[model samples]
Target: MPDLRFQSQPPAHTEIPRPKRAEGQWSLGYTEPLNKNEQSKKDDDALNVRDRILYTYSKRGFASIDPADLRGRFRWMGLYTQRAPGFDGGKTAMLEEEELDDEYFMLRVRSDGRLLSHEAVRALGTIGVDFARDTADVTDRENIQYHWIRIEDVPEIWERLDAAGLSSLEACGDSPRPFLGSPVAGVAKDEIIDGTPALEEIFDRFIGDPAFSNFPRKFKTALTGHPSHDVSPETNDVSFVGTVHPEHGPGFDCWVGGGLSTNPRLAEKMGVWIPLDEVADVWSAVASVFRDYGYRRLRSRARLKFLVADWGIEKFREVVEKEYLGRELVSCDSPPSPTGHRDHIGVHEQKDGKFYVGVAPVAGRVSGSLLVELADTIEEYGVAGARLTPYQKIVLVGVDADRVEDLVTRLDEIGLSARPSQWRRNTMACTGIEFCKLAIVDTKERARDLVTELEKRFPDLDTPITVNVNGCPNACARTQIADIGLKGQLVMHEGEQVEGFQVHLGGATGLQANFGRKLRAHKVTSAGLDDYITAVVGNYLVDRQDAESFATWVARAEEELLRGEKALTPS
Candidate 1:
């Protein structure tokens, strides 16, 4: 018979201490593993079999608890709230203190029209939850997050979130990430077709698919009808972009390979075009190829691009066709002429007499109070709803035309603005070292600081310059796709090395998806980094052609020349 007795104490030698690093070296620490006896005690203490599995799995670093166990763990607690109207009756809940042991508690929100309320935010905050500061982030899709949740709080938290219309699906790990579509899909003036319905359809198909849930690597997919490339379909692993074919019909231009990390690469176009009606089939086929052929053993090299690289593009197409259609697949017709970029900022006249006001929320940081204020304002104005932008901004859609000025004033009072100047329109950054363990610097704060200084120095700079800053090489800021990219690094300062950055230039999105080139490395000291950016922008503004943009100018400059110019500029 197997040993059944549980030990009262954890086994000796379970915890390991960190090795001493030399004074100048950077060190990252790892948690020590628990002994078998301690693990048994933990399992015995678990509230249920599902809780036991979660406790054990978390100890093993996999976080894999069976869905049945997940449901069982909360069933008796009344954590699963009723589904929001028009939703798929998915379980939604808030974390109780005991249930939140991981760095973050995963909550599923009602994807159907429900948005989180201000009261919900405050309730979480009053209970010592700090989503905004504790790496709370919004996914490429519209879901908001609150990480660093303690295990014990999981059940109660789930209950609260359920009451607030949030649920828990496969929000993390190898599962397909939430399907992204144009935030303004239904409201955009130039939309050929709203991609939301299709996005929802694909989302419903894959969210709990066993095959997708346990895939080798994370998969991200996006859809966009807006010509502005606001959803940035090119940067996702698989993308279906809304476009028109000259002779065929309305459809999506399929693309693959775009990702951001240590080695950022823009996705390459896979097929010429895919008709709207066949998008699901095309997506399924492409996913099947990735599922079968993608690298599974190596975590770092598991993205679709690596597969595309190992097997040449033609070979990849061959496999996709064979697996998807079970026969030869013919290329579709070419896409139509491209339309100019459009961002739904300022007051735009909707097809209806109503207007949509775009509000820029710097760094996407919104408190519970702010969220409540915005919702109340929306209610008061009798607007349709709010739309989140890829650029960490928000749009209040369908506001009454007569109340536009009043609405704008109210938004400004709450620190959200509809005004878009050259600098504020497109600045983006990642969470940096302040919260993300992998980050090397404080990117979001630094980005805002950098932009504020640049505006002061070059008051008349009218060009739209996108600056992206990632805390580390992971490139969460999409640094590789910006006009100016800054990745965190360590630089020697006063005999001791501190956090700094390696700067890159020239990257741009949309039709001109080019990787930014490394321009200079600068120490992020209080006295110097700002001056470097000012000088670089000033040089580009003064030297480039009349119509040439900042990116184009940076692309043309020699690396050495750019570095020297930046170094010479004083703070």
Candidate 2:
């Protein structure tokens, strides 16, 4: 018999307290053991990507770009291998790394809170037309993703975006990504305070700075003074939610360690009230804590959430205050509870008496041509500007009441709808096997098809339900918080590998924040999704009591009834 003693029972001598890790300490092992010749490049690998960009990529262009720099370093500058144009539905799952990669690139433009000047929006539209094959997407992060970029055109793209006062720098890196904010941060009628200045100040100071360029893993930040907590503060690593400080008047309440993905966690309140002026510095301090002490040994456990989880909120706060902030934060009131819907859809009145029309672009999909037309229409209507929402929607701000009708008409003409059906309005999908490498199935078009049919079937239905679809388990579309969440996977169907999804029900945000519970043994094949959803939703319609939300109904309903055994087809 093999001596199978568990590793948990370590030798007595090895049971000492582990040495404290140095600041900014991390160790990432190579994917494969290296030979003598390859081992020499270890030093080069140790250097940050900033060196490679200046010395290698800038000088060599695409032809002479190093392999490590191509796949890994480029992301530090917001570049990724996009699916080539005219790539039909082939190789849905990237079993082999090379199977999904391409020479073309996808460029992400960071737009914090969808804040952009009219000129910037127009410039983005033009860039999409000229470079991205007319394809553009308004991401859930309030950023824009453009596909079909070539490495050769990078410098020019940077120049054009720079002229618009926009940047792709550190957009998709291990460093802190773009700060998410409420679309109507400064102008919303119910806002606690204008947080635009704090967001802008943080962006101006830290973004692209070498001091904070490297991190154990990606860091996410969100700041919003909106009373509705419009940025989904509970789902980010660092968030400053709006709250009234009784004695101090308007200030922000802090939340930390919130994240989604393989493991989802709602943020914990830090019990500290941050004054408006000190928010930026506090934000920096939080980020500095992540940079200095965040786990670096294993990428899987490197997120700040893990650290926060291990240390608990109390110790984490102690470390942040002692090691980073060097001052005790003021204890303040809790964050304001979300009031009503924060989706920000439909035409609404702004604080300034001007009308703001919010429109959904069908799962965040929009073409360059549509963007151009929208820009022209906004200019024609004399609207102040536009803002992107975290809900994968856009809001046209500063529209006069007289011009609202014209703008709505123009928006409808461009295929953007202010009055979208509930199915269309609530449906969201991630970049699936269509472009994402980790995806196991299609999402965008599939979601669009599902929404189209659902709307047609129940045209007059008025129940509020969010249906989120993801390409994989990463939860980029926030599948966990949806009424009906579909996580993509591959299964054997009629002797062939076909797309399928595991369903989760009853997840929601706001006061009733909770992750959806996964259905027991209910996997719906892609071909049968339409019928499955219809049956479940139809069942909800029949059984639900007076004005009961879908999430509430699913939560109370029995698992067997919710599953609808007759509706789901076997994979």
Candidate 3:
């Protein structure tokens, strides 16, 4: 295959139109974009910088990099200049990208399906040790992300990745991101069908293919053949959830237009059944619809969910079939609700008579040394492989049943606990003010501290509660879908401004997916966050129905209790 620079343009689509209705949110409101938004730069094909990075700019260092590529086009290659050290949280919105750009960068290596061979893991870890300042973290997208990466070392990092059969291509920006796949796809006993082959086909056909490279905004996909719904398909741009039709045996139920962020929406079932063999084509058709008709005038409203919301599921289905696929789909019922074990934590029996052990680190903050140690330990246990989950956990696969106990014990020693406390297992957070330029407040460290505090405070609490914290409005940690979600921002504290958070109560996904409710005009200083959560959760512990979920109680609780009025002074 020829490189994209030499290849011809992809097939043309109908021009993007400004929505005549209620779609003109901030992104689309402008006629001729004043600041020359990303759309204009993308028009020249963002993927046209292969030689520039490898041949010119990289050799000359970051100083020689093109301004356009440095800030915008670099995302196509999954690189972002991390926030410079010493930039406080209060300076978040005040500084522009250039002013905040650190000499080092953050690289997100796509983990399509989270499959990691021992050799791949070791190579990645070695790169972290050699060049990335020994910094590596597992992201909720199942990616191995690195911080403090110098621009000069990027080519060397790519070389190591290639040797390990990996690439960061199309991992970020306005392209299809790494798709979420069930970690136990083939191993799970109750899996409908293995979605592995389908995922491989989709990646080979579309990833880095300039034809599908450009879109209105980033597109996300998730597919799972397991009943557990471990892939969290309900919150993706497009998802193929495992289901067995009464007559068709096992296949997939397609859902479209799901996404989280400022405007959260659950994906609606497309009322179609897709077979494994044809899934790649169906996926392409759905993506094509987004390319041709998705709103591009506004970056904020450009996500596929917005288009699906405006068109309605029926109309969206009509366009997908008539305009893109050219074939009608087999109508089928929606898949059943996911099992309670979406996280896939702890040891579970696989169909192969072996077992897979799932474990989590504190808020996904594993270092490169930890990665190497994990890979070495899995090798010692004779485990065939490992896979990452959207919940920011890792599962070692194909371990003998007899080795389960020993392996779990070893994992515990390495700080990856197979049997973690509720707080340790349930909490997830995004890279916040520590590294990300767009973040308003700290998240990773804050979440880690919160988990420890809560575990100590509620050692005997039985019911499970999810806590998701996001740095900004982007909701990278899926804040809107957690039982207790904290969105970071600047809030007035004691007549002065400081880092704080706005709370979202009772958010949940799966059978009854809905964004959490908010206490209007309520924000809590970061310092008081622990007290606020402890008090509110304590209130729930004292008064509740039998086996009542946090979401259920939150739905019925009074505003006073949810706000922790007695314990907190609201800002």
Candidate 4:
């Protein structure tokens, strides 16, 4: 594989047709002239990247690939050049931006709706081992990431995945990524609706379709019929949460414009009930609205959430109904607030009399060979299916009562613990400096260490806490909503640079969903992270009144006490 140096060119600029403004109401009307950057982003065809990768780069190998294609175009085909393994002290600060892309690539495979069959899973595992050097990680978005890939082998990998009914198209880039749905969609006993049919409809109709290949930026969608808010509706661009109307037995309530990054905002409800049949249409309309009317000037503010924030849910709903749906949506009752942990960890009975065993992989990191082992186990059971959860977990569905014990024992041996401890189950970590070019510090390893230390120090901790560690402010691990969110950065310790994290306290979801507030002047070096968190949790355990949640305690605790004394000088 040659190291190709493709010249970087400014993206093309073009004009989009303007929409007619509705009188006395706000709409996504293009009232302002487009800037050069905005024009470049919109005028540039995202679909062109695909042909270029397929014909030019694939034929000429890695050396002929252009830099522009490396960053912008390669993503259309779900290929990202990963950082070389040995670089340390965070890629962002350690090396020049252009030097970040080594010979290897991280291939993101779209597990649309988080649905995977036995054959597909097996095929993915094989690809990971054969092509990716056994490097694989399950992302928070329910996508499978494979590293150590080269340009020459990309076509063969695609063929293998396609043969198993999987795809990597539109998994990244400006188009829609993997669609999130309930891991227990069809089998959950407490579900209001199955939601699989709707998910399949949207996937078949829109995914990989050229009409939706281009957008201002990446778009995220989630659909779930579960009552526990298992799919995380409020944090997605478009979400359809299950609800039951008094007149209509069951349907979905719509939400729009939820996202997290440097600026975080929860999704706003549309107060409209969409029947099962209309879900796909509603989804398409929302994506079309984002593509046509979403802001294109600033890439930073181009997500659908920004548009929703400016328009307000009411006005946004009106635009969708009038311009897209051409019919008014029925108003319906809202669903109940989510209760308890929705990660679906541990074993539980499904509606089908069989069982589903949810297992947590530590920090969502698993080897390719381990995936193969799990796939073999699934085949042995001759079960219905398996799915990945938003919690960085996996659920083996449709296991009979007779096979549950044997499956659990086998899973435990493979490090996929069906009944993991709180540290193992609730802890989540994002790809850090090891593979991510934008990362400021190492996250996966640090998170694993923090979990281990916390478990040892606070063995009797009964209250649940979600510990999310993100390598950057992008919030890939959803640091904003975790009970204790750690955002990675570089810090000076004893006059030398060291890995550190900024602390965010008290973020909770469900009825009282809110982003965690940052703790001022509170930074802890990676070496002392364990001690600092242990002390903080120790304070919470001592002061908390009557089984108060960790987030609740952090909300009312004095800042001085919350920060703890040991954090004053982290060495």
Candidate 5:
């Protein structure tokens, strides 16, 4: 395949149109068609007739060829360019074709905004690309992903994605990516106001901005006006959390250094309280500071957390204050309120007379078909759009009171019904070794199996238990803050090597955030992992104090006690 250099294009400045019926609300649209000459040029640039044919078939599905013929065509495209169908044999070899690993491909999709689209999925199916829906898990950040996309599909996938309102702007290569917001940001009854508008504005500005598109390192930002810690602002590079200050008015309290990549660190407060009116400027200033001072020499040490650690919190704040305020920093007029709960699941009434439904996904995994179904469902039953929560759940906002029952029934039919007693509701996992090479175990599969078993053992368990599993120490599942956190590892049992996990307990996500401490290490085959987890939970339930969260219980448990509980024989 020829290395084509598509010229970098600047974002076109266009006025966002207001919906005819709403006052401060605007509707998002992507009606602009690509120029014919440009499309023709793109088609012509695709290698040969075979490449063009496969590209067309991928977009539409089903090629006019047998399996043998398809294999021959793929071989001709070369191993580097071919998209192999599964997790068996030479997977890395196939990944080598596009200069990216399968895990990076999934990350690219989430970062690029092209992961869950009808055309993108169809294209994968066309080329005999057996991408895994299970492998392409959702992040706690509310981004959907697909793993193992072929090199040939990249261009067409990107083009179709542009037409679908998904942009590849800063999805990868060290830049500020999607602006994270609460899945229920605008619709929650307790929300001071929806932060989506501001979030969308920030996204629009940073995604294509030359200054922000290629920063020194990856930058993450999240916003939420809701008091709940659902968005997990303490774990981002730059977080704008909603708070009410008498002098600053209703706005965000900014924090920096929180991230979960290589060197995990909680973000520290940088700005005391930034007023709503100054959010854009404050955010822009923080980005500028990161771009200018953030280390670029080493990938592992490139995050803003490293910068904060190197300079200390005070110095980091000094830099941001000097740059943002153009003078000395001032003390905060008011302290932030305590961090709230982590229950984004279950049914909840919105400030509007209608209700918002939060459905727990076994893992944060959604297919293109699911997305289409969700879109259709929202159009049919919802007054507004569907919002995604960081918990890998979907919130159907503004459903009519009369149709809530019908909506619930339809959701169940689609295999997305919310359950009050399911253990899977509180379980979260990151994409593991099946998709990401960085992962040491199959976190998603393990998490699902564990939840299923826990439900069977403790059928009526009502206490909200957060069990997070990460394939590696990267903590993409936010395991550090989970009540029961599991980081992937390989363990030896009776001189035989097997996949196992190290457990951490007592982690909490709040004002006094604390990373969980390592507990007992457990070794079990993938099939029996669940029974072991259930036993551990059973011990916690019996020993915990009234109203104590699982994390709190784990924190108070003695090491010997935890070890004994983990070593219990599975019933």
Candidate 6:
């Protein structure tokens, strides 16, 4: 009884497992998704891991956890089993990712750079203390990270987080990540417009939505109306930097495709001025373009940056406006050169005439107990709010003017100093080999030691230079954009293999935004890191122009000076 249409099964092509292309040509089949991870996402939505964790993994021990879910789906719930102990740096590439999995996990709680209530801060502190082995670090992306998490405790951790109005969902993985905004979002005095409403709307309506759950790679966003550029707009996938149209008062400028891993690229502007009400829509449209059109064949080229690079800004914007947004965006002028501080690392006045004290933790490392103490101080002082900055610093907003001095003194006693030295102020380090499987060298402790050495050797060397240390080439510490970016690896120093770094010089953001330039054949042994930096920085102090920034001086410095050839323990 069925009417059968004349459909013929096409004969199977006898091609091998190669892509449907001849050498370089990309055919329709070649453009199709081929990556195993892409297939995994299609087979099962990563969000389903929440239920699995609640009903299964939480009850079963680590041995009972499924291998696929352990390595892939667990990320959707903000869980990553840390690098197993006893694995040396040399084994980094030799073993599979699963082979490096540890019995413990690292859990990241998303804050999205929004102001957290004192109660919420205390709850997070408690979670860190009780569930995460007293480990907590405020990451550059504005997430609070905890280590030593066990699979059995995830359900309890989720319960504690839910009670505090926090969740780790979509915090990591190939999905929309926590939104990054100005730490001083609604409280800053000079902000032209607050961006929290936009972030809030996006988070509520879209972050966990299945439509965006299958991106080829993770999406990072930054939004802020503050002139300070405190959110690091230069290195995000989708950034809304505050700007104003000549005719239209104040709004934001949309920049797409900025990211900072192996293939470093600064975001390019779409030349459009977005009204406050339209920001969430514009952001969604941009995300849609990435979801539907991004490359999925190679994990290496999956970032939105690669798509934007291939299409160019004009075409990328055209596709969004035409296929996604059904309207035109108001044209805007070029972004103004940044004038305010990037780190926001000192006491500053709020619009309410209140003070917000920025406290620096040594390379963003802090204890769970110390965090609880911070919450106590905030409550004690009746501070208006608390936030984590993009530079891995903390700011207590709305500190009473009269109590500012006492607050600073108390913070110092707790080790979150209001006034940190130059070495501490400018250095940033990633979760190196101690915790991260991808890292090959030390970062946190090494950076701390480097700080001490630099302070002792060049306490009076006053040029502002940033030293970013990463365990490997992933650039998680934003190493590519630092004045002295160090990518860790093993190298032969003085004819013996040792842990060391590949140097990247002169990178910066804001007015002079650019990735650091590489020095060919330049690798410094870990033992020689301090000496190398001292030699290079010391040279800059003597040879630099009167007001030259460290990045500026490095741009003009000779190769010999940058390599610190004379100071290095030669290979």
Please count the clashing residue pairs in each candidate, in the order shown: 37, 0, 2, 4, 6, 1
Tens digit per residue, CA lDDT, model 5, 1-571: 1211112422223233333522111012211213332222233321232444345645554333333323222222221112223543223324443332231234233322112333333332232223333333456666556665544454565555555565444554455655667766666777764666666667666655544543445688787777775678888888877766666466677888898754678888765666666677667767766765555444566677877876777776665655444644334643354543455665678877778777777877666556556666666764465555677776666767888888888887886766645577777888776656455567777787777767778899877777888877778888888777777776677786567777776677786478877643444445556766666677777777777777777767766556544443334
TM-score for all predictions? Answer: 0.76, 0.90, 0.93, 0.91, 0.76, 0.93
Give the per-residue lDDT digits (tens) of candidate 1, residues 51-157. Answer: 45335634453245544344333222212211122211011123332232223333433232222244444343333334323333433355454444444555555
Which has the higher TM-score value, candidate number 3 or candidate number 5?
3
Runs in model 2 lying further than 4 Å from the true structure: 1-61, 83-96, 339-341, 566-571
Clashes in model 6: which pairs? 494-571
Clashing residue pairs in candidate 5 are 58-123, 80-97, 111-171, 138-364, 183-388, 258-267
Candidate 1 displacement at residue 122 in angstroms: 9.7
Compared with the true structure, what per-residue lDDT tens digits does model 3 show for residues 236-321? 99999888888998899899999988988899898678899999988988887776566666678889999898878988787666
Residue 481, candidate 2: alpha-carbon lDDT: 86
Clashes of 1: 37
Writing each residue's lDDT as its tens digit, candidate 6 over 542-565 gives 777778988888889888888875
* Span of ten consecutive residues with least summed lDDT in model 4: 1-10
| Model 2 pairs in collision | none
- For each candidate in the order shown, give its overall lDDT on alpha carbons: 0.58, 0.78, 0.84, 0.81, 0.59, 0.84
lDDT value for model 2? 0.78
Q: Model 2 over residues 334-354: C-alpha lDDT tens digits?
A: 775663247788899989898
> Residue 370 of model 3: what lDDT?
85
Model 5, stretches more than 4 Å misplaced? 1-136, 324-340, 420-422, 520-528, 565-571
On lDDT, who's better, 3 or 4? Answer: 3
Runs of candidate 4 exceeding 4 Å displacement = 1-44, 85-96, 566-571
Q: Cα deviation in Å at residue 27, candidate 4?
A: 9.4
lDDT of 5 at 386: 56
Task: Answer with 1 or 6, whichever has the higher TM-score.
Answer: 6
* lDDT for position 91 in model 2: 57
